[model samples]
Target: MQMSQLVLKTLREAPSEAKARSHQYLLRAGYIRRLSSGIYSYLPLGLRVLAKVSNIVREELDSCGSQEILLPALHPVEIWERSGRIKKMADVLMKVEAKSGDFVLGPTHEEAVIEAVYQDLSSYSDLPATVYQIQTKFRDEPRSRYGLMRTREFIMADAYSFDSDQEGMRSSYSKVYDAYNKIFAKMEIPFEPVEADSGAIGGDVNHEFMSPAEIGEDYYAKCSSCGYRANIEAATRGSKDADAQGVGSELPELLYHYTPEAPGVEKAVEAISDLGVPTKAHEMLKCLVAIDGDQRLVMLLVPGDREARVPSGMRLLEDPEFERYPYLHKGFIGPMNAKENSIYVVADLSVKERSHFATGGNKAGYHVTGAVLGRDFQVDEYRSLVVVRDGDPCPRCGSALTLIRSVEIGHTFQLGLYYSSILENARFTGPDGQQYPYYMGCYGIGVTRLIAVIAEHFLDDRGLIWPVSVSPYQVVVVPLGAARSKEIEEVAETIYSGLLKDNVEALIDDRKLSPGVSLADCDLIGVPYQVVVGSKSLKEGQVEIKVRRDGTTTKMPIEEVPTRIRELLGRSL
Candidate 1:
């Protein structure tokens, strides 16, 4: 491609609102332009990068025997209703009213894909079919940020597999898992697949491929010793004995203390500290009031220093909800009186290790001390409901865990019969003349999001450093003073043509711009290699080759430039 004719305008300053480095560089480098919040238009360069990523995904999935098929982005609302996801995914579903009827812009194609393949594989002999598609998806994201990472509309490579039973489904899942490993390996990025919650997708088991990044919004826990890793939502910690230390042989009776100024755990601790009693945040029993979908109040008890993982279909009690239950104090909630107030109480597993705690007195601005678990409060059940933290013991090997911020690049779900059972005509006839719902699996890769993740993952102080596999152009040829120096221009054009003939993706800077401007733009765009066709270098019968990754320069004879470039890219000369 010739830079002089390319429709791109490099920016000197990124937009003020572009906080993430990838977002800033993609805009300043002219890769993408924002159309609206959470929507973008990929320019030529950006589109090329996306195409390269999509191709890698396609090649990997195809090699695993997954046939490619495109499903409709516009789905009938009735299908979603029948699948019972219309209410479950209502928050992100984009509804549309048309002349025919109501429709939904698909955030995912689980329902659509099931409907598409229901008839083709009716018999057991035709079972275990996998189909994939690279297409656009839409979601009504409440807050989209960091460029393509979280967009309302973007391209995705989604695949669905159908099998006769759980065993066949797991086999297909394993194949796709192997394919995803190869796909990310080809992209040249560091990633880990961790056990994750299926969320609204509704699967019993799933894994999320994560790439560590400072700007990532998701977090995962990794065990340092045993190499156990899991997404935060699904991560678990080692269990402790119910009769662990901190339990006293003779516990003191629960006593209420007047703390008129205490509104939170911190303030209550302060008020108690003023009374000459030393206490730590972890010594306090924190009770979280929440309401389920049925409007039943439930009390979640955990250590003050820990946070409760709110289960699905439940949310923390809000102000209006507090009004509904006049007996429940907003900030001063306790589990000691839960049974009396008709509130179900669930306690974290860690709470069993500690017997006595400083807890709320169930009244505004009041707290209680010496409250023993079995003496004063009774828990209906114990659960691993606390968010896993750094230094937490690994559930698998009892090793200390480390938390990392990462972006989810891909996800694979062993959906079983979740979608197939709900969709119409999704059963197959077995050898015994009985019909059963097909066990299913779904996999997805964010095609456009990868462009940003790769940019974010591999970069320096100057700009984005895209991997060679996904770079818009592998080599950029810059001829210093090309318009003024005919010799330099001829040499650059010759080198560019030679590289192209050798199947190397090359770009020539033919614009009449200053050397500094062109070279800076080259670095900003992050092409893997730069062939400098300068007069001084040509005088030595050699040209300068600059490696973008390490900023190393090498001089080779002009005649060997194309071969050298091919060799550097691991291609046949």
Candidate 2:
């Protein structure tokens, strides 16, 4: 495309709301325009990059024998209700009311896709099938920021696989997993696949492809000894006391003490020590209350040294919620005197090892000095819910754990009959003439978020240095002294036309702009290659080619420039 005819404008400064470096460059480079807080419009240059991403996704999924099918963004409310996700994801689910009834802007297509495919497949003959779609998706993000990294509406490639049996489902899941690795490798981005929680998707086993970044929101722990990596939600630490012989084995008996001002564990330990009580911080139980979906308080007794880890399977209630139950003390709280059957008490598995531990007194200014788990107060159940610490032992090989921030780019779930069993008519007749629910798996790639991810990871001070696979244009021809020298313009245009004829994506700066401005724009736009047609270089029977990634420059014949770029791209034109 001719630069003079295109409606492109480069900005010297990014908008005030831009936080991430990639977002700033994307705006200044004239690739995208913000329409609202979390909504954006792709400019001509941005559209080209998105198109390349879409084509790559299609190629990978197609090669894996997955059929492509587009489902509607607008779905009936009944479908989500039938899948039981209406209540599960009500916060982020965008619901609309029409005169006819209610409709939902689907954040996912599981309910719709299953309902559609289930209607036509009723026999065991169609045992295994896969369908996917690359389309727009919507979610009501409370705080959308960092450009496309967190947006309310964006493009996504979501695929679902259905099989007749568990073995077939496992095979289908592995195939999609393999395809995901290929897809990211083709895009040339560094990534890590970590074990993950299923979340509201209601699946059994899942994995998330995380791209490490300094500004990532997700935190994960990876063990060096066993190579076990998992997102925080799925990460776990063993209970300090899994096996025990007797209660308070090291200590004599359960002792109650009066501590006037100590509320937290650290201060309580200090106050108890001041009173000549000998105890370590780890030999204490931290008590916290969380109201479940039923609005009932569930008490968690975690080891004092570790923070109370609430499982994502249950949501925690807020501070204001404690007002409803006056029996529960805000800071100094425990299960011994939780006020008349109003709370259900549960303890962490780690608590069992602390034979004689300290606990909250349930009364302000009072605490228990020597508390035994089975003797003082009985717990309903013990769970491995301790929050994994930085130096925590690895669950597998007992090595120190490492924490890192990462971005979640892709996720795959073995959705085993969760949606199919819930949704109506999502069943098939087995060879035994009995009806069975379909085993399903879901795979997703954030088509638009990848633009921000690639830019964020593969960037320098100059601007966004995109990978050749996803760069808007592989080559840009910036003719130095274009308006001053007709020969340079003719040579640059001839080269650009030839590159196009050779099926190589190329752009030329035909505008009457200064050489500095043209080159700066080229660098900011981040096309993989830049050809500079300077008069001096032309006089020397050569032109200059700059590699955007490494800033390497090579002087080559005007005729050989396109060939070098194609070779660098490592693909046919």
Tens digit per residue, CA lDDT, model 2, 222-296: 998788998887887644334544653575565667887888899888888888887678877788887665766
lDDT of 1 by residue, 28-110 (tens): 99999999999999998998998899999999999999999989999999889998889989999999999999999999998
The lDDT leader among the candidates is 1
Question: What TM-scores do the predictions have?
Answer: 0.91, 0.91
Off by over 4 Å in 2: 238-245, 248-253, 257-283, 288-299, 312-346, 362-366, 378-382, 571-573
**lDDT to native, each model:** 0.89, 0.84
Tell me the lDDT of candidate 2: 0.84
